[model samples]
Target: MKAYSKLTREELQTLVHELKKEYSRYQSMEMSLDMSRGKPCKEQLDLSMGLMDSLNSDADMCCEDGTDCRNYGVLGGIDEAKVLLSDMMENNPANIIIYGNSSLNVMYDSISRSMTHGVMGNTPWCRLDKVKWLCPVPGYDRHFGITEYFGIEMINVPMTPTGPDMDIVERLVREDESIKGIWCVPKYSNPQGYSYNDETVRRFARLRPAAKDFRIYWDNAYGIHHLYDKNQDYLIEILAECKRAGNPDLVYKFASTSKITFPGSGIAALATSSNNLDDIRNQMKHQTIGYDKVNQLRHVRFFGDIHGMVEHMRKHAEIIRPKFEIVEEIFSKNLGGLGIGGWTKPNGGYFISFETMEGCAKAVVDKCKKAGVKLTGAGATYPYGKDPKDSNIRVAPTYPPIDDLKTAAQLFTLCVKLVSAEKLLAERTGEAPEKAEAQA
Candidate 1:
């Protein structure tokens, strides 16, 4: 149980030998377990089975306003859907536009629009000499991918427990005219479930960017996703805060029921200022007659209201909370005080971010993959898939069942120890860890 660094050469070698034997046994099992993405498990997905039944041939296809959902022409969304998502997104019904299934899709479209047409009559980003984005380190990889796909230069901002370093964010946006936007997950953020504190939210609302088109892409993916009923993280409604700060057009907030109901069929939404919505409509008008109104109506009918959605999420939390707790328990029991690595115990969200010894993360992940377990690639959390420290690994626990998660988590910790011991042994003896271990 001693810190690996404090162990003698012989002791470290012995530990590595034992760990290798255990790892070999795992490999012989030839099991294939994946923890590479934060996806809702079958049990969690099962909770929303009634959604399909919410709409049937026997049900009326007309919305509350008497518009038949079967036809097109409601470019924004049905009124009932707007109200449902508005309550969930914490915006006025008039300000929210419900889109098709995925919030990620909405975000991608937003970025694409900004690039081709521009935000609210601003210069199109494609015409700009340089387009830059501020991305918080250890942030969402898909968010990074979108910016990278558009050839936008991404700058990393360090993340704190409260939020991204506002001192840095404020200075960068104020001085750089080409920095168009920053990606944020604000509540129960991905990888690390750190929520933005009040001061951070205020500073973000008050930011006076050099670029008139600068926008905050607020992806509140887990706004109400909490593991604990009594203890939960609350986020300041960014759209309202922006309006109060006299920068109503500064942020575009997004959300969806992808996790709540069905990942493949849930409704997505964007809540923003009228100016931004108007600009988006100009492009959306040509895009299609409208998004699937039938799907929107289905979501509205299924959830019934915001209260119903809250109750539905409670059911989701019941299924997911234990998976999170078990991972925390396994990590603490195996890796605590080892001085080798550490991990986050998120109260909500689907992931737990682990920070390994610098330069050891990639090796640990590779070891796990070889032993029939898969983890998110090392350095995948950062922009451009490069982690300068090469230290962080995101552990996704939501997809697998409880038993499989337990095994995967234990294997993950075992890899951490095996790699940490190898790293220390290499540093002390100036011999390759494999060579030293063979000599042991």
Candidate 2:
């Protein structure tokens, strides 16, 4: 396949014509396929059905510390749960606070707590004239959504395979007193699946942000989601590194069994310094008597220990690893050397970051939707739903069945070619494709 940019105008026109025909055939199928979200399919979810039986009427329902699972007293969490999640989070049990099912909920509340009461007795963010957040591009959209909801101005930091551009991140946080925080998915990151290298993590720990209350919102959502046993990505433990750097309160690290077990019904947790935990606990005491202890106990009993949890993730990798491979294969076959686009082949994580030629992502997405396939919106991976180059689309392959995903992936590539060819043809002829055709 020729690079679309190198093709003569006639070559592009012919390719576009054939691609439109292929697309039309797909449209005629009347399919209602979705690749919009990174959700586990039924087969993957069934792997954890043992969780349902982890607790039963015959069960003792008491944790290792003799706390009744039915009780409301453990405001932070049961001790056993902290140990299990601490192992998963790679931090001390003392630093862990077990939340309910959603890590996103925990993150939202963290921001809200800062807004109403402020972090560790600083002035409330609401009282400040402006609060800014640094968002790494080709990053998680929900992270952006959280900051935007709080009315914090978000600045874009470009992402490399190693991680976000550290030079830009350090400079912005150092000089801007208004910069309150940065959202990080350091390990097996959301869209790109690129883990932060050692230097990046070290620099994050050593950052000298202007705001005393500045924090790194480190959401290690896919920390254990490895696609291969031998070839896994390792992330340096952020909390420990921060503590060693004498910046004990510099990060609020979060992780969950959301993807590991059930999507919304699994347990979540936060790991951070004693000072930060104390500050959070003060607000949490008013929030609730406790979260679901029975659920926590069930999870602990189900996974038994961190070793059991790691083995369980292997089962998950078996199911979704092929899905990731299929998408990568199709992308390679359809658009590999065309120079119209490129996509990430992640080792693990839920999404693939696809970069289209400048100004063509939205068009490709629109084309896919019209052909009965839905995708994560173009520019969604960036802050404020805006991709400055108008490139970068997120491909979620886990939700659909393998067959449906194959169809969707094929249509996606077709749309990419169709859109890219049109854009190239328009540039070559000095007009839009349709206008140029009419003139011809």
Candidate 3:
């Protein structure tokens, strides 16, 4: 029950030996389990089977405005689908533009458009001498990837429990014209599952940026993915908040039903001011005549309204809640008060972010992999796949079944303990050599 940091060398050695034995037993079982990606389990996906049934040969294929669902004319999206997504996104229907399946693809296109042309007729980003973005640390890698692909310099900003450090964000955005945007998962952020508090949201909305074109790329991916019905994290609507702060065109919000219905077949949308939407539509019209209206109709008919969507998400929560609980319980039973590691207990989201000792994350993940248990790689949560402290690890318990998740969680704890002990021992014994010694 003692904290690992407080344990003497002799005690650590004994603890490490016991953990090694347990790890060896797990390895002998040849258990192959994965806690890598935040994907829906079979049962969760099964619940959405009604989506496929919503549209059949017998169903009507017409929108409220009498647009044929099989048509190629609705450039943004069909009217009903836009209404459904607007309510889901918590934005005005007029400001929502429905896209294809992946919100990520929508994000990529936004950056691509800005690079080639410009955002609202500003100079193209590619034509700038230097462009930079503010990346909150322990953030989503894919968001970072998009910026890195554009060769934009990404500066790391620390994330507090409330949100990304806003004092830093405000200063940087105001001081540097090249700092164009920040990638934010404001509600139930990818790994930590923490939503931006009200004050954080307000600060973000009121930011006085040096660049006229600077925007907040708010990806509200898990807005309704709550794990508990009674307990949930709420985020202020950023678009509205920006409007109130006299910065109506300062943000581009994104959402998708990827987790709600089906990932590859769901509807994605961008909610923003009328000005921003108009700018996006100008480029979007050239890209495609329309997105998949049939799929949009299927989603709308299946969910009917935001209330129906919420009820369905409750069903999803019922399936994945226990898996998240299992991960939390394992962490509590194994590492609580030991100080070897710390993890998040999220209200609603697909991941649990774990932080090992400053330098032990890579070893912990590698140890798990060696024992036939797969985990999200070390440094995966940060930009350029580099966690400066090399401490954060994202645990995704949704993809695997309960039994497999249990095994994976157990193996994960063992790896955490083993690696932490080894790290502590090395630090105690001064075994780590200096960089000069390594070069020699």
Candidate 4:
């Protein structure tokens, strides 16, 4: 239980030796476990099987407006779908547009459209000399991937418990004309599970950006995803707050049932001001006749309404909350008060972010891989796959079964100890890891 920092060189070396033997035993087991992606476990996926059953040949295909869901005409999604998602997003139905399965796709297309057609008639971002984006550290990697793919220069904004540093955010967007947008996971954020507080949301809503096209990409992906029914984190819904602040078009809010019903197969949506929705529709008419309306109908029939969706998500919560607890329990028991690392105990969201000593994340992940356990690649939580401190490692516990997660987590903590000990031993002896290994 003693902190690694207080350990003598001999003590640390001895610990490393014992950890290596344990690591070797794990390697000998030839285990191939992956804790990399936030995929729902089979049991969790099974909870939504009723969604498939929600549709059948005998079922009525006519939507509320009498539009046959089997046909393609409604570009803005059916009235029923809009109402359902709008209710879930806490926005007006008129402000919502349901898309294909993935919200990430909607996000990518939003950026791509701005690059080519510009936002609400501004000059295309492709015409700009420099395009920059604000990326919160330890954020969703795919969000950064989209901006990075478009050759957008990303500036890292440190994340606190509440949200991104607003003073820096306010100052940067006010002074920097080229800074176009920021990626936010406001409710139960991707890796750390931190939610934005009220003041942070207000400051974000009130910002007067130098760039007319500046926006906050408020991806409320986990709006209703809670591990504890009573201890949930609340996010001040951005679209409404922005409207109240007189900056109705300052943010684009996105949500999906990907985590709720099925990932990549569930309905996605974007909620914004009517002006933004009109602009999108103008261009969207040329994109396609419509997205999968039958799928939209399927979702509507499955959930029946927002209340039904909420009840279904509670089923998901029941199945996965224990998995989150298992990982937290293991991490707390093995690593607590060790001073070698620290990790988040998120209230919701698919991942738990772990911060190892500076320069140790990659090494720990690498060691875990060699022992037949896979973690999310180190530095993945940052833009351009680069972590300035090389410290944050995301632990995805939801995908694996309970027993497998236990083994994987134990291996992960072992890797942490081995790597931390090596770093310390190297510092004290001024020797390379290989040399330190030989000595240990």
* Better by lDDT, candidate 4 or 3: 4
lDDT of 1 by residue, 148-183 (tens): 999999999999899999999999999999999999
Model 2 Cα lDDT, one tens digit per residue, 120-233: 999999999999999998889999999999899999999999999999999999999999999999988889889999999999999999999999999999999999999989
Q: What's each prediction's clash count?
A: 0, 0, 0, 0
lDDT of 3: 0.89
Worst lDDT run of 10 residues, candidate 1, spans: 431-440
Model 3 clashing-pair count:
0
- lDDT for 264 in candidate 3 is 75
- What lDDT does the true structure give each of the candidates? 0.91, 0.92, 0.89, 0.91
In order of appearance, the predictions have TM-scores of 0.98, 0.98, 0.97, 0.99
Clashing pairs in 3: none
- In model 2, which runs have C-alpha deviations exceeding 4 angstroms? 437-440
For candidate 1, the per-residue lDDT at 191 reads 86
lDDT tens readout by residue for model 4, 350-387 = 88999999999999999999988888899999999999
Question: Which digits, one per residue and each the tens of the lDDT, describe model 3 over residues 346-418?
Answer: 9998999999989889888988898898888899888889898989999999999888889899888888888
Report the C-alpha displacement of residue 348, candidate 2, in angstroms.
Answer: 0.6
Candidate RMSDs in order: 1.0, 1.1, 2.8, 0.9
